[model samples]
Target: VLDPNSFTGQEFMMWTVAVYGDGWLNFWKELKPAIKTVAPGWSEGWVKFTTNEAPLMVGYATSDLYFDEKSSDKSFIPSEGGYIYIEGASIVAKKEIKDGAKLFIDYILEEKFQRLMAEKNYMLPVTDIKLGDEYNRVPTSTKLVKVKTKDLEKIEEYKKELIKLLKK
Candidate 1:
């Protein structure tokens, strides 16, 4: 997911800011050396971490309920304002979306579906919905990063800069 050349690269789009918070690029230079491995994807990282191959890895704070493992692994919310990565829905203005797709999007946004997604998929619902009691055990941070919309336009530039920084 960190591959800068890939169309779906998410390091610039989400991971950097969400995982590290503000000024993440600055801290990355110092932290990269200590990082033993950068898993190709989330599943690989989580597996390595869970199996004790990796001490720490990027993962969902709600993973404890999902895996039900006892360990020293702690979900950390970066004090500098860690951004919660929440995927959103949007229709491309250039593409013509049929009624079926529109209905599907609307359906997913509903509280009932949202609650189901939270329960089964382990994702945060867009709207407030009562989740499982185990959700209460997950760590939450009041200090959340609010990404600037203007910075979104600079993603490609940030990608190049991040790739360069990673190479160093």
Candidate 2:
């Protein structure tokens, strides 16, 4: 339901204000006590988590799948809420090899290719690919929500606000 014309900068700001409320600036202030240390990036955060320096870290739900066979640890979407990420394959416009790109996109949607992606990448297939028993152990949630494309337009602003809040 993303109407390109309706998603102006003013609308995006209003949406953010409505969803976050007046105390949005205090978000990081409230969570600061629980945060041990903020890593520079995801790799550093993962290292900290693996070394037991941090018991918990923010990461994708599929993260635990990497250690599923070797570790007892698991990742789950909390009951409060979770994000649904949809990965898509698209043929690039104005590409010289447009036909080749289309073929690649078509191949990605095929069952065999989708299955391979699910097994190797530890990702849920966008297609109707059936996963094996191994994937059953991975936890999934029904309460996941997807962000609208219009909302995504404000992501940079949100990130800037988050950085400013964290700095305080």
Write candidate 1's Cα lDDT for 87-114 as tens digits. 7777667566788778988999899899
Looking at candidate 2, the ten consecutive residues that score lowest on lDDT are 1-10
Please give the range of 10 consecutive residues that has the lowest summed lDDT in model 1.
1-10
Off by over 4 Å in 2: 1-25, 68-72, 92-97, 146-150
Candidate 1 residues lying further than 4 Å off, grouped into runs, are: 1-24, 92-97
lDDT of 2 by residue, 1-168 (tens): 111122232232334344455554464467667767666555666788788888776656777766747786777766644655456667656647667788888888899988988888877888776788777776777764545666567666765675555555
Going through the candidates in the order shown, the clash numbers are: 0, 0
